[model samples]
Target: MQLIESISKRHSPRSFDNKGIEQEKIELLIEAASWAPSAFNNQPWRFYVAEKNKNPEFYNNALNCLVDFNKSWAQTAPVLIITVVKTTYDHNNEANKFALHDLGLAIGNMMNQATVLNLFMHQMAGIKFDKFNKLLNLPQNMEPVSIIALGYLGKIEDLPAEIQKVENEKKRVRKPIEDILNYSPLK
Candidate 1:
């Protein structure tokens, strides 16, 4: 698929079919993420994935990290992923200012890959990161960035009433380039 096509198709879905995705597809998503460019080649992105159908324990562990509102919808997903970024460079233990940015790039790549495969990924920052850190036993250099709910598209009506209206009515909007672009730096 083309870049624009993938970008246009990509959406953070709130509804998901509770079916197991093939392992190959999961590997493809990770492989796509691995291709993202990073500063000094210090790729700091890490993904912790749990397939609900295959491993209920792992999936429940991930679900416990989400806020209640998110858990209500996210529990239906086949996969939940915890994304993390290494905040420091391994060499000299220097701060990596672009760590999060690099992680975002990796996620962007994965989103496009998912779109190409007719899958959906919904990412949220409403996670209790400390819970994830405690449960996953994260090293000092790593930190939870976001939680992603992933699966195939499901009936919008499957969502809770409050969210169903949003699914039915919401439209994707983008700010015009003119509104964001500035030729000169403003003081």
Candidate 2:
């Protein structure tokens, strides 16, 4: 699919099918994330993938970390992907300002790739940080940034009323290019 078309079609789908996603496909999605650009090539992102059926307890625990509204639909996604950023780059390196930005790029790549694969993805920030960190056994330096729920698409009817309302009115909304870009005259 073209980039523009994919961008338009891609959305945060809250409802997902129960059918399992192929392991290979999941790997491909991760591969897509791996190629995303990083600051000084630090490659600080790490993904923790949990297949729902295979690890129900872990999945439930992760889901429980989410806000009640997000939990309502997130539980149905076949896979839960926890995105983390490694705070340290090297033994002496203390600054990692771009870690989250790099992770965001990787996630954008993953979401776009999912759209091309006819899959659905939703990045969620509504989570209990402390609980998620402990449940996933993440080190102190590895901060969890977001949770991505992945699976095949499901009917909008499956979503809660509040979510369904948002989904129904969804359309690509963005700021004008001129508004986003500034071309200052030389001083």
Top-scoring candidate (TM-score) = 1
Per-residue lDDT of candidate 2, residues 1-187 (tens digit): 4558668888777789889899999999999999999988888899988888888887888788888888888887999998899887754578798889999998888888899999989889998877877877777778888888999998889888888897788876789988888799547
Model 1, span 20-99: residue lDDT tens: 89999999999999999999889999999888878889899999989888998898799998899899997768999999
Which residue pairs does candidate 2 place in steric collision? Answer: none
After superposing all C-alphas onto the true structure, candidate 1 shows an RMSD in angstroms of 1.9
Candidate 2 shows a clash count of 0
Point out the worst 10-residue segment of candidate 1 by lDDT: 128-137
RMSD of 2: 2.4
What are the models' TM-scores? Answer: 0.93, 0.89
What residue pairs clash in candidate 1, if any at all?
Answer: none
After superposition, which runs of candidate 1 have C-alpha atoms over 4 Å from their true positions?
1-3
**Candidate 2: residue 41 lDDT (0-100):** 86
Per-prediction tally of clashes = 0, 0
